[model samples]
Target: MANIGIVIPAAGQGKRMGAGYNKQFLMLMEKPILAHTVRLFEESDFVSEIVIVGAEGDISVIKELVYYQEFHKVAAVCIGGVLRQDSVRAGVRALSPTIQRIVVHDGARPLLTLQAFHKFLEESREYSAAIMGVPIKDTVKRVDIAGKVLDTLPRDYLRAVQTPQIFDREILEEAHQQAASAGYYGTDDASLLEWMGHPVQMVEGMQENIKVTTPEDLLLAERILTQRR
Candidate 1:
């Protein structure tokens, strides 16, 4: 088994979800969204430890969930910083020294499967970094600030990125440190490496790996769960 460490960033305010709380705490079927996400790693053969990063006030709640849910893979509950990248940095800092590889996943994306996890881990062995994403199917347009369509982007070359981005521990740490020193925050972990001139591979991601960002997304997740059952 690989000495892989997973960092789940769940500290978002989730104002768009209109849940008045962290979306990770929102129920998907009978389980919280965070629980569902964590369960995937718990059931994964490649994951060795998990560090959940959340708001300070919610740290206890996450710890309680880990205990009651019997998620033995959970090694720590970290208090997140203001930004998503900052929270990810905190989680990275909390990883055990034995961790050779790091995977950063979104807590709201609970549709990830064990197969995806395995695939990402396997790719990590060959590449310094790899991320899961699907090719963009919609016609993409480059619009200006005034909302005028500038040009049609080549959809064939575009990808809609998702989480469980895998990275070697050294590369991830260097990326994070460089980002902090440069005061630069990328859209995701892979972007950080990209900014550092690192090459990252994109693996095929499941279409169902949707992120629960809005109420409609939550409903869709519920329907997906129902259909799976």
Candidate 2:
């Protein structure tokens, strides 16, 4: 079995969440949102180690949370960079060289399931990289800066990508290196790999696995948590 490590990026300021504090540190049910995400990986039998990349000032808080919660699988909690891609790179670099595969998940996505995680890993075994995504239900339109609709795009070919993206360690590392060298930044890990001419497969993701970025999302997350419990 390949040594699988999980990289969770929790350094985002969560400007959309409208919360004074970082969204990851916000309360979700009885615990912090990030704690729930960490616990999920810690409880999973397939996850060998977890590396969390957080904001500079959040290391002590995250460490205390991990210790208090007794999250055993957490191998390292390192400071993250300004950008999301940079944070992911930091987490990936923190992983042990022996780790063959890595899964990058969002700390705000607290509802990620074990089944979805397993599926991503299974897909990564066949494809060098795989990410969770859901087909866009609404019709998309290409609008200009002035709000003029340039084109109405068919939703059939569109999929909203989600996190918990799994990749072969070497492939991901190379992609990050290429992006850094080219002074390029991607919105997600898959984007970086895709730009490098790597085939990135998409696995259907669950609707419950949402990134909590707004007040409405927080409410939905609470409901999902309650239903799961």
Best by TM-score: 1
**Model 2: per-residue Cα lDDT over 86-188, one tens digit each:** 9999999999888888999999999988777777677667877889999998889999999999999988888999988889899999999999999999999
Tell me the spans in candidate 1 whose CA falls farther than 4 Å from its real position: none
Please report the TM-score between candidate 1 and the true structure: 0.98
Q: What are the TM-scores, per candidate, against the unseen true structure? A: 0.98, 0.97
Root-mean-square deviation of Cα positions for candidate 1 versus the true structure, in angstroms: 1.0
- 108-127 in candidate 1: lDDT tens per residue? 99998788778767756788
Which residues of candidate 2, in runs, are more than 4 Å off? none
